[model samples]
Structure formats: structure tokens, C-alpha cells
Target chain A: MRHGKYRFLLGALTLPLALYGLLVLWPYLQAFYLAFTDWTGVTSEVNLIGIDNFTRMWSDPLFLAALRHNGLMLLAVPLAVIVVALGLAAGTRGTRVYRVVYFFPQLLSVAIIAVLWQFVYTPNSGLLNGLLTGLGLDSWRHSWLAEPDLALWCVIAVLIWSAIGFYVVLFAAAMESVPADIMEAAAIDGAGELTVFRRITLPLIWDSVQVAWIYLGILALDGFALVQIMTVGPGGPDNSTEVMGLTLYRTAFTYSKFGYASAMGVAIFFLSLTLAVLMLKFTRREKVELA
Target chain B: MKTIRHTVLTLWALVFTVPLLWAFMSSVKTDAEIFDSPWQPPATPHFENWSRAWEQASIGRYLGNTVIVVGGSLTLTMLLGALVAYCLARYEFPGNRTIYYTLVAGMLFPVFLALVPLFFVVKQLGMLNTYHGLILVYTAYALPFTVFFLHGFFRALPGAVAEAAFIDGASHAGVFWRVMLPMARPGMVSIGIFNFLGLWNQYLLPKALNTDPDDYVITQGLAALATSRGASSDWSGLFAGLVIAILPVLIAYVFFQRQIRAGLTAGAVR
Candidate 1:
């Protein structure tokens, strides 16, 4: 058995490691190098250019717009998702995790969600207008995804709608783990629901909410699928809804400027890393010990 | 309080659930009806929309392709992920922590950072439009989440059973294959179901790597259906295609709600 032990260990580790290296690690390293070079994605001849792409990115309006949109989502979507998900999850302790609300959107492909919402936002004969017309609120009708000012918000709405259910369940699970006696004691002290939530429920489930912040923050930064498939011009109604992921994709694939796209990808990587670290730093709290 | 809560929950349910119900309902409405009366029940249910989307729009072929690739990759991810987790968990060998952290670190970086090189890597291998290529890459990318999630599960298992198996002259591989593997079924099933949903809905990898039209997976095919001719004249059929894409996942969620939820919220658990 000892003789075969080393062989078994080596055998087990080899394939997964090799696959990981070839597909994940190698490409990641190459992406950094390619970000600094001029690889047209069609040409075999590559030459290092030394941060030219990064310098160009600061001046490029499209990349800046994409960065700003990601930042906006970074602020807006996580707050909305956390607020709504926590509201829905409040007091629903031990609720079974089978809500169709989450599964419907969470399980479906982005393509489906995009197409579904496209019809919903269609200006003339779409669901939103039809609902408005039915409610005699004809003054409210507009092309939801076509209006530049309204388009990013529309995408953010979908992002929040699709995301809230999972966190609701996650927070509810956390709430369940909070001892019944603590909640009961809070209630016995004549605390209102809001007060109890603020003083007790919030701190007890602070860890889960923090996890949610980081997850939703990263998710907000990667709205490629929603923005790509749903928005007008695929990235525009004046580029209002363009995101970093879509920018990287279009920069690479549409323009075939792989090196430039690689630069955008690296920028996104550092942005997310910073976002994660910031969330961890700012959201840190003194541990709440239950008596 | 209960009344208010129920009211909010009910309204919340309607807000989120109605769109899917509407998508399914609209799938059966004529294109004109869908346009004219978005909220009404269809005047006449167009049962043929499903068939049209399945046959003329080629959603059937794409679904078949998705099943093959997702199925192939899920199996490989589970087997390899479990093996890696087991070896790392149960043994102390050189480079163990390094390999574990290396695999776990794969999760932190966004896939977009790797997309450019990964595309060329596959292209250089002459596997740009191949099933095996996508399957291998899918397994490779999925390794991180699987190993990370299963690592804790493997660590928690009792050591006595494997010890007893070893005393009975079971080879190390035999003890793992027989004793440890069966004990890890719950973890495997949870992650497996989650992996299925994720890989099933995967659009980025396929959209980037597999551009050949003949190899469209579910998301790619449905995306094409939206952009091209079917989107203009055949709205109901497009809705049908959307429903067909989502229905299997909804069904799976109903049955495996426990495991699926566990898989999704596992990171939040610890």
C-alpha cells in the first residue's frame, strides 16, 4: 500500500493540475503579457509595447464609459439587491429554499432573460406599455431600453430582480441559525420589528450580509450577458449600458484587437480585486457573541 | 404583522413570478396577439409554436448539443474534482497546500481575464469548434468551485471506515473508490446539480470559443433566434424557445431544491 501511495497521489494530482495549468493559469499569465503587446489576434507576429494599451485606455471614452457604468452598478446593484433581499428574507426563518422567484431567473440563461425583457420593454406593443395602458397611465409609456438615461437602470432592475431570491434564502438561512431565544428576548423587551432588526437581526446575520456584499459586488462588475443581449445597439442607446465585460468582449472579438481587449480584462481584474478588498475592509465588524 | 408580511410576500411573488408565467403564456399566443394584448390570455393557443421553435428554429439540435457537452463535462469535473479533494484532504505529501491554493485561486480571477489567451490556446490546438475541446475546457474551469466546495466535505468524513478498509487489505485506490467515494455522495450531488445549471446556462465560453454555427448550444441558439429572422416575425416561437430552454432547470430545481440551495449558498454557510 505504501509503495502504491506515492503513485496514487501523483496520479490523482497530475490530470487536474495539467488541465488547470493549460486552461486557467497559463491563459491568465498570457493575458497579462498580451495586455502589454500588440497581438491583433490574427497575426502571429507579436511585439511588446510597454503599457501603451493602458495609456490609451485612460483616454479612450468607450473604456472610461464602460468603467463608469461598472462603477455605477458596483454601487447601485448590490445595495438594491441586499435591501430588497433582506426585506423579503426578514422573519421568514426556516423558509423552504424552493422559491420559484429565484429559480426562474437564476436558473435561466441570460439570453432568455434578455429576450424576455426585450419584449417587456418594447415601446409600442410591449408588456410595460400595455400594462400602463391598461392602468390608464398612458403618460408613463416610453421605450425602456432605448432611452439612454433609462436603459442602464432597466438593466440594473433586471440584475436586482434576478439576484434577490438567492440572497433572501441565504439571509434566511443565516437568520434561522440565530437562536430563537435571542429573537424572542428582543421581542420581549417591547422592541418594534424595525428596532429588533436594527439592533439584533442585523448584527447577528452581519457575516452573511458581508458575504452577499462581496458576491453581489463582483456580480455587478460582470454584467456582460445582460448588457450584451438586452440593450439597444447591444452596448448602447448612446453606450449608456456598456459594461467592462462587454467592452472586453467586443474589443477583442468585434475589432480583433486582442491585445487591447486584454488590457481591458486586466483593468477589470484589478477593479474586482480592489472592490473585494474594499468590501472586506469597510464592512468588517466586531464579532457579535450570543449570550 | 402576518397579514402585512403575507401581502408583501404575495406581491413580491407576483412581481418576480409573473414574467416567467407571461413568457410561457405568450409562447402559446399568436405573434399578433402577443403584440396586441400582452396581458390577456391567448385568443387561440398556438400549440405549434413549440414544434416550430424546436424544428425550424433548430432549438432541438442546440438542446441536444448542450446536453452532450454539459453531460460530458459534469462527469469529468466530478470525478477529477473528487479525486483531487480526496488526495489533498486525506494525505500529507509535498506541494499539497500549494496545489490546493493554486486550484482555489482560480475562482478569484474573472474568466474574461483568461478569455483572450484561452481562445487562442484552443485555436492553436485546432479544437476551435469541437465538443471534446469545450468539454475539457469546461471541466478545467469548473475544477475550482468543485474542489473548494468538496474539500470541506471530504475533511469532515470519519477516518475509521477507510482505516478499516485498509486493514482488510484494500488498496489505497480501492478504499477511496469503494469507501470514501460513497460517503461523499451528498457533496457530489449538491455540486453536480449546481454545475449542471451553470454549465447548461453557460454562454460566454461557448460564445467565444465555439463560433461555428453548426455547434450552437442552448444559449447561443436562442440568442441567434432573437437576433435573426425568427425574432422579427415569429415572436411566439421565440418565447417557446425561451421556455424550452428554462423548463428543464425549473423542473430540476423543484425536485432537488434542497441540494441546489445548499450548493448555491454553500459559500455563505461557513
Candidate 2:
């Protein structure tokens, strides 16, 4: 019976496992190996350069700038998204209508979202500037995606806008799971709404919050599609909006530096792994089991 | 206080809706109208814009391509994922846990890392720019989530029926095909819808693997339309393309909002 069971399992697993190993795992392992080589992506000859790509990355201005942009996004986007989502989620407890409305942005592709925002951020005829000028606040209407200092922030703002909705829905679901009676009891015990949220609600949904953080951090790290589509030169206006994903893409595809790009990929992999681990560790809290 | 919360919620909801509504409105407006009054009702709605975008800009081809790729990928992913998930969930064999963990860990592999090598791999297999290449990659990528979701679902089901089926002289394959799979339909539907939305909206994989203009997916096609030089003159058409691209997903979300929400939050909360 044991042998028969193993045979059945092997029969079921063989095809899927083969496909996965070849297409997914094999490529991943190849990428890790290629990171140390001097493969230009044009020719078949890939010479092992032994961390030269990694060493060069330390002094590469473009790479460093891209890393810095991703760093900023990693911190800013998640923080802004979580705070607003938490507020909206907490405030709209009993309602279902707002949840649907807020989640609308999450439905569209990042490409579509970027295109929509392109029109919104257009200089003269864009909705944002038009609204600002119509309100007699022309001074506040700088070119949203043009100024280098403000371009990445513009990208981050779009990131936050598109993302906050999903987390609002996510956190709302988590918040809703916390019994209303507990909140009411806290309210009766002279706790303000903020205090009740801080003292009771936040702790209970810490797991969800941790997951949201990791997800958002991964997203922030990969602001590639948005930056590729929305920004002036595709992570331009002086490369202020450059991100690691975009950098890796340009390195591999544009410059044809496969080895160097693979090194960037390795860096991103480690960075993402570290961030995920650190978030899981730091967000650890006493398990609040509700009866 | 309650009113304040409602107001804030309403305002934020507007923030999400108005941009999309604005894009939709702009899709029907003439270029002059879009530029002249950015927020006004179009004096004469150019309904032909959609037709023009469909016919002139090659968005129709892109849409067709996307449907094929997404459809093929979803079917394969669901089928293969169900097989793997059922095996891992139902049978306890040597290396079962190892296989399951490895599959789950594939979810965290940053796709961009494998871009260059995967490109070469596809090229070597003579599959670049083909539907098969994109479909296969998407299936492989979606396996982790599909297997993960379905594994949990299969575990939750009562195994007595499968046991009875086996005892009744049904082959293991017969029990799996006729009983276990039918019982896991809800899980399949949820994950299927999720995968449909995801694969449809996928930008990066298509961008990297399939660069042929003729074979571009909807996202790629829409992106090309937006960024191309002639975009300035075809603003209404561009808006129309955006609408056409987004409509299916939006409709799906509206109809299957509950399932979509459940699928999205499934991994997060638990």
C-alpha cells in the first residue's frame, strides 16, 4: 500500500515538477551562476570574472542612484500607504460601499494606471494642474513629473495612490475580524478612538499588518513598471526616479551587460530577502487570540 | 465623528474613482475638447474613438493575443497546479514536504533576477516571441500560488468520498479525476479568477520575453500607444484603448468582487 501510494504521488507530480524545475528553478540557478561571469549577452563565451560585477556596482553612480530611489520608495510608499489604509479601514468599519470604491484602482494594470496618471500629471492641460489653476493656486502647480527633485515623489505619490486602496481593503478585512464588542467595551472604558485603535485594534491585526508591510516593501522595490511608463525618460528627469528593477532591465536589455545585470538581480534578491526577514522579525508581537 | 469618518471615506473613494471616471470621459471626447476643458462634459462624444483605437492602432490584435496567452496560461496553471496540490495534500511520500516547500519558495524568486537567463533559455528552446513561451512562463510563475491555495483547499475537504470511491474499485486516477477535482471547484474558481486577472495584467514577463510588435499583449500594446510619437494627435483614441484594456478586469471585479477579494486576501490574513 505504501509503495502504491508513492507510485501514485510520483505519477501525479512528475509533469508539473519537471516543468517547474526546468523553467523556473533552472533559470534561477543559472542567473546566480551568471552573476559572477563576464557574459555580455551577445556571444556564447561567458568568462568567470569572480565578483568583478559586484565590486563595480559599489562605484557605479547610476546603480547607486537607482538603489537610493528604491530605498526611498521602500520607506515612503509603505508608510504612507499603511497609515491611510489603517485610518480608512478603522473608520469605515460597518460599511461595504467605500471598500469597493477604494479598491477600484487595484483592479487596473500598472501600465493602465501609469497611462491614466500621465494625463493627470501633464503640464499645461493635465487634470491636476487644471484643478490647481482653477482653484487660483497656480503657485502650487509646478510640473509634477518634470522637476528632478519632485519626480520620484510624484512616482511615489502614484504608487501610494494605487496601493493604498488594496491595503485599505486588506486592513479593513483584518479590522472587521476584530469583534465590535471589544471596540465598544474599550469605548465604554474611557478609551478614545485613537487610543482604542492603538491599544486594542493594532495589536490584534499585527500579522496582517506585517504581511502588508512585506508586500508593500516588495512592490516599492520593484517600482519598475510605473517608473518605466510614467516618468519623463523612463526613470529620468536626471534619473531621479530610477529603481533597481529598471536599472537591471536597462543593464541587461539596453546595455547588453547580462553579467552585470545578473549581479543587480542578485542584489535585489538579497535585499528583498533581508527586508522580508527583518520585517517579519521586527513586527513580531504577542499573539492576540480572540475568543 | 461618524459623519467625519464617512466624509473622509467618501473623499478618498472619490480620489480613486474620479481619475478612472476622468479617463473614461476623456476616451469619448475630441482632442480639442480634452485640451480645451479638461473636466467638462464632451460637447460631442466621439464614440468612433473606440472603433478607431480598435482598428487603427492594432489594439484589437493585442487584445486577441492577450486573450490567447492568458487563457492558455490559466488553463495549464490550474491543471498542473491542481495535480501538484492534490498529490502533496493527499499523499504522504518521501520528499513531499521538500517539493512543497520548494514550490512555495518559487513565489519569492524576484522575476527580474531570472530575466536574462530565462531569455536565453527560451531562445535556446526556440520559443521566444511565441505564445507557447509566454504561456509556459506564466504557468510556471503562477504555479506557486495555485498549488499553495489548492493544497490548503484539498486538505480541508473530507477524504471519505475518495476513500469510498477507491474501495468501490475505482482506480486512484479515477477517484482523483471524478471525485477530488469536482469537490475542489470553488478553490479552482477563486484561484482561476485571481490568475486570470493577474495573467491579463502581467506586463513584465511579456515585455521581456515577447517583443514582437505583432504579438504584443494588451498591456504592451496600450503602453506602446501611450508612448508612441503619434500619441499626441490620438489622445481620444489612447483613452479609448485604456478603456478597452481595463473594461474586462473591471467588469470581472464588479461581478466577482467577493471572490476576488477573498483570493487577494487569502495569503495575507492567514
The candidate that wins on DockQ is 2
The runs of at least 3 residues in candidate 1 whose Cα sits more than 4 Å from the true structure, single-residue gaps closed, are: A94-103, B229-232
Candidate 2 residue lDDT tens string, A29-143? 9999999998997566889999999999999999999999999998899889999999888877789888888887887889889998988998876889888888999899989
- lDDT against the true structure, each candidate: 0.87, 0.89
TM-score of chain B of each: 0.96, 0.96
| lDDT score at residue B205, model 2, on the 0-100 scale | 93
Interface RMSD of each: 1.7, 1.5
Give each prediction's root-mean-square deviation over alpha carbons: 1.5, 1.5
Reference-based TM-score of each model: 0.97, 0.97
TM-score of chain A of each: 0.95, 0.96
Clashes of each: 0, 0
Tell me how much of the true interface, by contacts, candidate 1 captures: 0.70
